[model samples]
Target: MQTIPDELTNIIASKSQKLAYQLRVAWDLNDFLATITFAVVGTSVVSGQDIVKGNAAAVTEWDKYTYENETQYVKKYEFIRETGFPLNSVIKSRASIVLDNTSKRFLPHALPFGTAVEIDDCDVATGWTQSQDGIAPTISTSRKEGTNSLNCGINTAASENTYAQYDKAPSVIDISSIADADKKIALFLYVKDKTKLATANAVEIRIGSDATTNYYRIQIVNSEILQNGWNEIKKAATKVGTPVQTAIDTIRVIFNEATVPASVTLGDLKIDYIRICDSTEEDNYIGSFIRGGRFIKLFSGYNAYSIPQFVGMTDRPKNNIKLAETIINAYDVLHYLETWQMSTGYLLEDHRGDEVIAQVLADAGFTAGQSSLETSMMTIPFTWIKKGQKALDIIRKVCEAENATFYVDEEGIMCFENRYHLSQSPHTSSQYTLDYDEEIIDVGLEPTEVINKAKITAMPREVQASQKIFEKEGASVINAGETLELWAEFQDDYGELPCTAITEPTAGGATSYFKGNTSENGTETDKTNDLSIITWETLGGTVAKMIFTNSGASKVYLTELVIFGTPAKVVKEISYETPDTDAQESIDEFGLKFYELKNDLIQSADYARTLGDTIVYSFKEPKKSLETTIKGLPHLQLEDMVTVNEGSTGETYYMYVAKIEKLAEGYFYKVLLREKVIQSYAIVG
Candidate 1:
């Protein structure tokens, strides 16, 4: 050790400094600090002298002091020496030293703390040999006054005192080859000028090669001392005062193939000291160094960033101060909250079933305060898309229709990206238009809305219960408008989707037109008591005009109808009403049902009472079934049930049940009818 001073600077615990700030307050936080000699050299190395020494290192925070990024950069100097009067005699020539992040000219990871050991600055010394452990040669020549010291800036170009010496800072000591060796090496560094930004400039003591290549480094403390006219970097480290920076670690290079390189420079240079000791003497680390880590909370789980190795820390919670602050980063607290929200959504979807789409729409921010268009394909019973204006209401119909987003093409046509699109029949003219000034369908990553011509030649469809028609006295409809509506209700070919509904009468029916006396146009009733529905009304006298209606070209096929014997009867019906259709494999708002009527010749006056709800009924049809199925209807209501098995008895009888307690006569309801009756009651359950 060098000559002992009158006072000893404490590296771990102290008595003098604490007494100086006796009145100062200490918060309720743990007083945590790393002991350099203790961690790096263990108990043996410090058995006599301090292998490394320092007071306090506090310049690692943001906004206080910063170092250059590139290991090298440029700077202009000031000329401050007297001119011409032999000023060259006293003025010194000093080499410029660049601060580089990927540099190692100083102590490998840091500078020797107590008193620094350096090699001779002459280029001719020993031809520049580096120890296998990376320590540069020791300096033997006497210190000489540097010559290139001058200041040249502004109006005054006089010779001014310089701060940092470019040729003489801390040199990095590289000993990476012994990383896994059974020896512990302690690195010492000299730091200075740790203060405010304008007053301090942090110098980096890089311990590695090019950023892309390898190693470690630290912010050289006391870099500001250079600006303050300090020449000897090693001399500054020996001062008994507050230290600016420090380091000790075992962490190796990250070696990321895809990480951005931080600024720092390095080049052909020399090394000086390498103090390697047996592993039994100490741990391969440097403690007094400010190399540290932090804890991070994550979404999938929680983890900790362990400290780097060279700084002497290898385990998590590397430091007490860091460990205490992150104690509350619990995982279940966040996981359960997220899970609860997702589960809630699932329950709502199941309870509301198909209506859940509307429920979701209700929460959408944009849908508020705006009226939606009615979709012909939708059973939405709203007034926005009333019949007789379907063409004019086409755009609005789509908006009001559920499961649709609005769209506008350049040609100025407002439309929807709905599959049930009331206007199922695509526009024959390619000149389809939309509002160009507004937002349109770019959903699902489609850059532009591609209007594809999809000719739906076939589909897996469904049919609804048969619709009954009553006779009214009026004119013979030119379009047989009432006939089209009636034929659909009495037949099976009208598919489920409104666009799939049958609008024309088939020629094969026993009586294609339910021809009867036309009724006087008087009153009407709104469609009520149903699951989902679309509404329509007759236009002129029996004309059944459906002009410009937004409910696009849709058809309705009544597969089965239920008539109550106690309700009102009907003949050939003349009123108009929107038809119910089939299952939407792709966002369809329609429904379909099927019934096996009792008669080959069904009647219109069979219904006696209007049921409260449509009974549940279903059937399966081939996916490719098209328009040809709407040919005829079964004309029966009450049929024989007793002793009726599958056979052509060729006998006709009205089927009914009555009882007299005198002597009850019982009969077998057809095995099929028995099953049907059981299902009819099952619906209410």
Candidate 2:
């Protein structure tokens, strides 16, 4: 929950109050693009109006100005008269003058890019490594396509051999197939270093199977190829080694000097992208990284003292323009996790609940702040296999494993709290209290469902070892713009186990992974590598197929294929029943009430039993849930403990805030709460 000021708390406790809200959007911190304000009841004076000579008197609210020659302007309005004779004054006749009158309100403006914050400068080349030989290449802020560029510095000694090499993973690159498709492959490099262009004689680019094996070299000697900011240099690579390329593993850049000098250092030689493409298809092969850091800030207060209500990353704004106003709708940072999927081959095994949650958030580029994610009480291992699963789903699964709650707090930070959070000493006490007859406008209470039986199903990975479901040897090729489908049947009678992962163990593995759909009729789920069980009861057993498509200009090669999954024998189940006589009587009166949960993260029977007991104990009896409309309380957060007085029944209830909604132009709050109960036994003296 947010901390409210003492003065503001006193103001809120008063009978009457003033309310105001401000919404701000920006690309980064301290760099605001738009700031809008809305008040409950207020008036604003419109300013900046044009004035004409000999027109009606200036209005009280609008400012007036006069201009001549389109460049000079004065704040006062004036008119002039001409004299015809030297001694006698004469009024000159002139046509009625016309002036443009336009009025506009003053508003904040957006700042220039890279002026308010530092630009992202991380190396964005995925699945690649870099090495330097007598020359240091570092990530630089200057970029042409992506978040950053690579700075290739020259050697201090002129005669020394210096070069920087970027090496791609061997499993993802196939030069043999690329050469077969296009004999004249082109190397596209974007470089910029105007200050030190004269210190180098030429720039040499090398692409090869390895650092010193079969390779191709291109020498760029023209000074025009180097520019002040960014220049795209395209050159067709020529074979320098074995006359034919079999594989591509490394790309090297060298800055050469003609004369041997005492020292020659290229200050800033930045390279954006080093793309290898077919000579005819140059632009289609370039790729870029998506930029982030857009966020929103919401503030609420009375008069001048405002407190931050919500600060979060924003989705794309939806703007609606009408005759009188423009409204924008934006979502919070949690929306990204709901839409983002975990990458292929992402697996977590034998990790704690909090560790798994932290890993998932880190993989999605989010940081968990002020978190209370306690370790699970169970000693069993937890496993999560990422097969096109959303990040939010994984987080929720982990939360369920630990019986915890996860949310984005008001400060745009991820917060995780275990079930013990509310049951703990200080948190078990009410944080605030409200009088039903005085503070609440309306209130209603309804009876909630009672559960007498609870069941939990757990799937543990240790019960069954991962068995190889499919295997293939030798090379398999897929032509450009074509698809390749492979199928395999399950060897054992293990019912309903998902294929976990697909891998290539041979050297120089598959060229690239493509996105495709997976189904018996090719219409169901879509994924990067369509590896799914399409036919469960076909070919006398369970059969699965994977479809691979080559969407690029070059052909793709898969050297080996292996698929593995755990059998369904690992699944375990546990059940619990309420032992209290009152709970049994309520169950008999209301008919049997049941609740069940199936989670792969719950591995131990003890843990499952504890979870079941917690669920059944909380729902053993009918509980009163309340929904009330009350004065605005911006400091209150979800899951906060609050006490509510019931004037009709003359009773007070301590409840947990389940949900909160702002209404009536942010001046009131509608809140839903559930009764909090203690389950432990106490002995009387």
* Each model's lDDT: 0.20, 0.49
In the range 556-659, model 1's lDDT, one tens digit per residue, is 22222221111111213322111232223311322232222121011112120111011221112211111111100011011112221222344322111111
Score residue 260 of candidate 2 by CA lDDT: 37
- Which candidate's TM-score is highest? 2
Expressed as tens digits, the lDDT of each residue in 27-91 for candidate 2 is: 22211112211101111223431111111111100111111121011111111112111010111
Single out the weakest 10-residue window by summed lDDT for candidate 1. Answer: 20-29
CA lDDT for candidate 2? 0.49
TM-score for each predicted model, relative to the true structure: 0.15, 0.49
| Least well predicted 10-residue stretch by lDDT in candidate 2 | 59-68
Model 1 regions lying over 4 Å from their true place: 1-620, 625-685
Off by over 4 Å in 2: 27-294, 313-323, 368-380, 463-582, 678-685
